[model samples]
Target chain A: MKLIMNLMASILLSVPAFIASVHAETAVIVSLDNKNTYTSIDKELVARIFLAKVTKFPDGTTAKPVNLKQGHYLREGFNRDFLSKTESQLSRYWSRLRFSGKASLPKEVNTVEEMKLAVANDQSLIGYIDAMDVDDTIKVVHKY
Target chain B: MRIGSIIGSVLAAVLVTTTVQANSGDLNIYGFMSVGVGILDKNEVTIEDFEGEGNFKQDTVLGIQVSKQVNDNTTATGQLVSRGSSDFKTEAAWAFISYQTSTDLTARMGRLRIPFFYYSEFLEVGYAYNWVRLPSDVYNIPFSSFDGVDFTQRFSIGSLDNSIQVNYGRLNDELTIFDENYQSDLKNMAGISLTSTYGDWGFRIAGQRTEMTLDTEVDEAYVSAVQVATIAQMTHSANPTPQSGVDLQAAASALAEAEVVFVEQRRIDQGQTGAILLAQQMNLDLEVQDEFAFDGHVADFYNAAITFDNGNYSFIGEVTAIEYESGLLVDNRAWLASFAKRWGDTTTHLTYSTSRDVLNSGDSGKLQEALNLQGEDKSVTLGLRYDYDVNTALKVEAQYHDEIMNRGVEGDYAMLYSFAVDVIF
Candidate 1:
């Protein structure tokens, strides 16, 4: 009976660790190139680029910010990590832009893999995705 | 069409669109109303033309906005404004689609505010600002819009907040009064605004550029007179057109020719000091020759504000400066200082403010500070304000003007007093 109890206890301890590994998913800022590396961006320029109000980085390179499909986890993660606005307020801001005659809206993709693909292809692109989903095809600039 | 029919059409459309986007009962409705009177003392006025004693007035404004969420990431909003244009007219204040990328980064590709002045964002919603009207001296740029996009991002440092708003768009409009050209060129307009706020202090620096084709018509008389004189000169040089004076005749003819044209064209092109770019080799028609000139302007505006609360009183002061590289009519640099004292649970508050439109530009469009000795120009307004509620107020204002451009003009000083009651809902 003592040996059976020890085996059961050991199984329970390992079960939680297995579940943690199964559910763990990291979030990362996926950009088009090495320019947006975490160590490279100053806090000020990062805010500007993500906000859509800035098109150029501090180094004079143009920035093309993109986002995940609406209402996705990567989208929510982006808000929590970088942008602090709610999705609805952001919509209203876009409405304001439709008639303001400034710039075009950022491109969008439906999934993390799609966003990563787009970001990797263009040096000007900026987007976010599930960190675990990123592969050698894309660069992980900043993760949260 | 009747107002009722217009209402019916809108309601029907809303009902139809509601189904696809949760047309259920998520919609909300709101309205507003206001009325008031003006009591003024017209001191030393002539009763021959008209007369009035203590006037009573009424004003009405109404609007309804339909706002609802289509999903977690998008919302649709539309507003209909009525009787807001002085005349009985209905207009669309805003109608657009909005979608967000994230909480912090969002882009609006439809129509939106150009973010020109401090109060520009809330300019239409009177209740969003202090006073019955925005300080006209600073908030008076004409229509602001274009087929454009707007982007905003906000980040914080320690406890301080920093925000940047950028806009780019093309605009086409005609400016009727005192415009060198009818359009502000807005053809190519884009600007960036950077603002920082820490505690009660905030500062803003914004710059924008506009280019135009300089498609303006010249003063007909001025141009014609020049042409006729040139003709007379060549004729005189060739045939020596015999004048009443070998010397005096020539001078007399020149002066006479100028007088006839001046009398006919009383409204001279006032903005330009002399005949416009005619001598600059612009496109001029031999007979009413029309030429195109290239004129563009870049305006840079900056403002700073400080708000502080002491006990139960709130004090806010705003200072703004607008520098125009070339084209500016009036009210460039202005500063207003206001102090308010609250009483009775803030039901009644008394405030005093002094506003001045200082002369910072060479143009007289800001006539109150223009270098004109004689004219109905603007001046500094020192007024006492009393508010009975958040939406109503009584104000008595007095203005004092000084004439700095009078080399020998008669009246050098002017004073005006007015009392008005303003309300909003």
Candidate 2:
């Protein structure tokens, strides 16, 4: 009975860790300001923007994509939306693109506050933040 | 001619307009430029009467690329590249469209890269790769564009990080230079590659298949003229050296070797038909005003490449093969291995790499072919790179080339090097 209980406990402990890594990437929806007029962003377009593959938004407003420096929730959200690539993966990808003249690397801003401020200030700016970080100033386009 | 001029004018207009668009709202524009000086430390080798060492400033390049995003998921990219002296002339290096699927996968279509090896996609990005230049022998095929679709997917497998990519495409190109002629076609290319990582180490393995038809015509007279002209230039370039005359003689001899072989092949094609020989020679003479005229080259080509990487270090190698229908042997292979060590937070790295190409024996129709192969050629390079940040950086590189004469084309060894800086606006 004790062994069975221990086995159950161990299995339960491992599941979340496995699940977290496998699902570390999240799908996010983003927009210009807190208007919340559009609630969903196309999954593919999100990928294109983060990879610097896309230049326009759904409504063709010329979406300005902002990156949350290196270690912010919004940046992670953005990565998940566009490439699911981490900083290193991004580095390698850019290395290839830089050589071919396909695209340049994205702009980096270190803090979520900086991210929020930048996105809020620009009419075309789009950024990804955690669901909890969303406020009246930044509208939620999609959430994972 | 008028249509060509009109098209050229339109292209120029569009480029001017795009440059004006630079960065507006969702639009972002960025690119890079570089220039450098090179020298040959050694010239005039005399082991087997070789005379092509010690030339410099023959290795300079410049490039510019622009990209725009159409929507959240779809994007378009166009790149124009140039190398060698004179402000980087136009080289149709890269032009394509790409799409991303979620965060884990992306796809691209249009004039895509051949993806023959790990560096195939970035062969010209001397700033990105370690080598001063890829081995000319291994990457000898003159073509790198294709109409195809490429798909890349990234995900995890157990404790490993994995990415797999597959590409399919077709390509065709033609060339005409004096009397040497080449025509080619590559149809239906399908290839798959995979990259996996465990800890700081990563690895790649991939392969591809190609089918092609190639047609070629060579002008003996034009080739002879070009050889003589090139010899004259080399002699002028080598004037300061005492062995210049000897080098000239050796070059002339090599030309003779090629001539003897070419004429033999021509005679075979002529066979017993004197009328055929006279008619073909007349046509060839008209077609080849200078150098050698290129005939139509049609063929299907395929390639595969694999790579391995460790955070502070990496190595990538690839091999590409193609069969030509134009009775000429067009098979070649090249590989590059690199190792790098990085400094601290500032991001400085030093690396060394080498590339080589080996030519395979070709098929000769009825005509006795010299198979003018010396053996293989290789380029060894050492370089240093510094990245102040992702968008800005600098690189320096040097290379030494060793040549082998195949059946009979003059082969000369050279030493070349360069330094470059990259920036964004």
Candidate 3:
């Protein structure tokens, strides 16, 4: 009975830690060509860019923002941490802007691989992905 | 023949340009649709032709938008919407061409939304807002669109972001009041708005002014009174006798009696001359027309709003005031407060809204009654929204509306329940 009680306590303690590790660290990324022009970006600016409030990069070039498809875990993590908005909140925000003709929602890619490919192909493009997925083709501009 | 062929060639060229650009991935198509079923517990509250029992078509709508990038600096966009309130008639909601002058400035021209309220631009897009609908007391403006030019400028100061918009426009449309339609025109409509945001807080202030003209059916009593007054003046001018003065006073008193006679005569014979003779004897103005016209009227509106959001909790409050210089339109003040809490995929909100019209003792009885009817509505709404999918939400709401006044008299209250689905693609 003592051994079983001790085992149950350990399992219960590890459950929360395991769940916390399930949420991946998110990174805001740009094409390799934009690495020199945009080495690092502040969180505020990243939020604004993703929200379509700011449309241009620091170098004065038009910023094309891309996003992972809805329901993607990394995308939700990025929205929560960097944008400080939930998926539903962002959806409502984008709907308002999109319908009003004030701004357009970011283009969506189905997977991280597709997002990286899209960003790599366009110098002005910006997107976010799991930190583990960052490689040579894209530059990490911000991480959360 | 040459001119016709040249015009045809120009048309073909334009068509080709549109087709090629659309195929080049420079064009985007988007749309939203919302449908709802609502039931009023009692027939106490009425909106236009919708009242009594249950209604399925009152809140149904669909909108389609297309945008084309003409170049790096220019883009064209248009939206078409069909609403159940208009009997599912499709109309152009927006048709504008925007030019990006710089990173922080843009200019646009064409038919655009008149931003009288914070949600004016997306008012029809039900998926955008939290409520089942925006408070009708405040959002119920006669005109929603204008042909205009506008400039928008955006900037940031430290952690605060700001945007300013200025516009000038004109609108010519029909406005409906009490189930009667009037020809309405607004000229030289100009407005400015400023919005600021910092983290989870947002604030906005906007003001607008316009010169207005309206035409409506003349009241029978008013027409008769004016006719009698005119005839009295003519008789007095033609003959300066004491007997003529007495006759004029009698005619003025008989103006009310002449209404039945006028109606009877019109029914018997549409163009009988006997009625004119009777009206003339009563000192009526034979040249009176059937329509009442009001021109050179001025109207002004101002509004302010503040919002705060911290992911799990959100709150918004707004106030608006409208005034007419000529007293042709009722002056009104309205306010709304809303609070919401989000838990996972569900959000629950409560809202309170009220409106009152400022009545002037100096106004005519008829005008005062109309203004009173316009002034008094208060409502409390409870709503829940569930994100059923990535791009869809299911919402249910119940509103209790208390009518403070109806037709210059105290009125009763009502309750409404509604269920809706809002989707975007």
TM-score of each model, paired residue for residue: 0.52, 0.56, 0.80
RMSD of each: 14.3, 14.9, 9.3
User: Number of clashing residue pairs in every model?
Assistant: 31, 51, 3
Best by lDDT: 3
| Chain A TM-score across all models, in listed order | 0.72, 0.66, 0.80
Of candidates 2 and 1, the better by DockQ: 2
Ranking by TM-score: 3, 2, 1
Mark the 10 consecutive residues where model 2 chain B has the least summed lDDT.
B285-294
Give every collision pair in model 3. B227-B284, B227-B285, B357-B375
Question: Model 1 over residues A54-144: C-alpha lDDT tens digits?
Answer: 5555445666778777778657656544654445334433433332322334667898778777877877676666655767877766555
Q: Model 2's CAPRI class?
A: incorrect
Question: Once model 2 is optimally superposed onto the true structure by TM-score, how far is the C-alpha of residue B92 displaced, in angstroms?
Answer: 3.9
Candidate 1's residue-wise lDDT over B1-425, tens digit each? 69999999999999889776664644433333333332323433311111134323222345555655567456565656564333546655555555655444546565555676555654544333334344444554555555577677765565466778887876665443321225445556777777775543556667665554334434555555556655566666776535722544455476577656554431223323232433223432222122112355455556665554332344556666665543223225555555555443231233332233333322222321222312222245555555555444555555444333231133244444445454443
- Best of the two (1, 2) by lDDT: 2
Candidate 2 residues lying further than 4 Å off, grouped into runs, are A1-93, A98-111, A116-144, B1-23, B44-59, B85-87, B102-105, B174-183, B197-199, B218-311, B317-327, B344-369, B386-395, B407-425
Report the C-alpha lDDT of model 3 over B1-425, residue by residue, as the tens digit.
99999999999999999898767987899999999888888775674234878798988999999998899889899999999977898888899999987667989899898888788888888888777667887888867888999999988776688889999999898765554566778999999999888888999999989987766323455356657766786888898689779878777767756555555432112112222334445454433121112465678999999999888899999999998664334578999999999999899999999988775343232343433334588899999999887679899999888878755578678788888899988
Q: What value does the lDDT take at residue B42 in candidate 3?
A: 77
TM-score of 1: 0.52
Clash total of candidate 2: 51
Top-down DockQ ranking: 3, 2, 1
